[model samples]
Target: MPRRLISSGSTFEREIGYSRAVVDGEWIFVSGTTGFDYGKMTISDDLLEQAEQCFRNIQAALTEAGGNLEDIVRVTYILPDAGDFPKCWPIFRKYLGDVRPAAMMISAGLSDPRMRIEIQVTARRSSGS
Candidate 1:
């Protein structure tokens, strides 16, 4: 099967030498995505807002890969502040409550100080989906 690459048109993808997501057959591997609104090249200061944006970015990449949030089988969350993780539960549930994919969170520094959270996901497209 042929592999496919997806891009969000974020400058970071080109500058850092990475695609937003890679599709290998039915599997899609999304890169660690932050809250930046790629169209405006801007990010929010609020953690919740940033968290929401992260999903939006991830959703966009998945859509381009011919999958949706429900296809996500695994997800990884990275945050600069561990304390902020709990604050994002509602937002997470709002997006993935029903799907409830496997998930993990880690505390670590991000490339940009402005970035509070980063989300990466792995999705598999169901046959005929």
Candidate 2:
């Protein structure tokens, strides 16, 4: 099996020495992604807006890795404030409510204070689906 790496053209990826996502055989592992718009390198202060952008970033990575949000089998969310998590549920549901992948949430600090949410996901591409 060959491994492939995906980059979002974010300077941080080069500075940090990490790809935005990696594909190993049937599995695609997307790194923890914040709300920053890579094209503009800007992040929103609103938690819900950040959550939406997080999903957008995740989706872009998944697509580049030859999969989509529906392919996600597992997901993890990290947030600095637990209270802010609830405010993002609606946005989360809009993306993963039906797919309903195995999910986990953690209260933790992020690299930047403006980032209220970070998301990581693992996806598996079936042989024939």
Candidate 3:
């Protein structure tokens, strides 16, 4: 199967020779997407807004792979401050609720200090191999 490159204007992807996501057959791998608009890395301090942007970024990549949020089977959330879980979890659950894709959360440093959260995801397209 020919692999299709996914780009959301993420700086890391352009700087490191990588893609925001890769689509091969039915599988989609979304690189760690930070909380920012496409092509911009610097983010605001609001944890909830940042989380929402991260999810949106992942969704955009998934869509490019001929998939959607409903197709996501797994997700990994990385947060710089775990304490913000309370504020961020609600938004996450609100968006991914019934889909109930497998998820993991880890608190760690981000590439940019201003970024508080990053999300990586996996999805399978219905028509995909």
Candidate 4:
């Protein structure tokens, strides 16, 4: 199948030469999504709220590619501070539940210091995806 590009209206996606999400065949690869919502660059101070928005952004991208949270096969979470993991993990779990896909967490300074969490996801439309 020809690759399908998903844009978020975020100019950076075009400026940096990448789409918010890329779909190849039945697989969808969502880029590392930041806390910024839509075209807004403002980052929120509340980590929990920021995390929620992150997932929401992923959801919209996945839906555009013929998938949803249930289709997520793996996820990578990058956090500037591991200490905030405890506070935000439960909120992530509430969204992922037992169907939790493969996930990995790493501590690294994000592009923006105000960014507490960033997530990238891969999903597929397999019979079991």
Scored by lDDT, the top model is 1
> Each model's TM-score, in the order given?
0.97, 0.96, 0.91, 0.92
Clashes of each: 0, 0, 0, 0
Residue 81's lDDT within candidate 3 is 85
Prediction 3 global C-alpha lDDT? 0.84
* lDDT: the better of candidates 1 and 2: 1
Judge candidate 3 at residue 33 and give its lDDT. Answer: 84
Best by TM-score: 1
Cα deviation of 87, candidate 4, in Å: 1.1
Rate residue 53 of model 2 by lDDT: 88
Task: Please list the C-alpha lDDT of all candidates, in the order they appear.
Answer: 0.95, 0.90, 0.84, 0.87
lDDT, candidate 4, 28-86, per-residue tens: 99999877777576778999888998998999898888888889889988999888888
Residues 1-129, candidate 2: write the lDDT tens digits: 799999999888999999999999989999999999998999888888888888898889988888988898999999999888888889989999999999999999989888888999999976642
The per-prediction CA RMSD against the true structure, in angstroms, equals: 0.8, 1.1, 1.9, 1.7
lDDT of 3 by residue, 4-120 (tens): 998887667778899989998888998888888875566767888888888888888888788888888898988888987677878888879988999999999987788888888
Relative to the true structure, candidate 1 reaches a TM of 0.97
Error of 1 at 4 (Å): 0.5
Order by lDDT, highest first: 1, 2, 4, 3
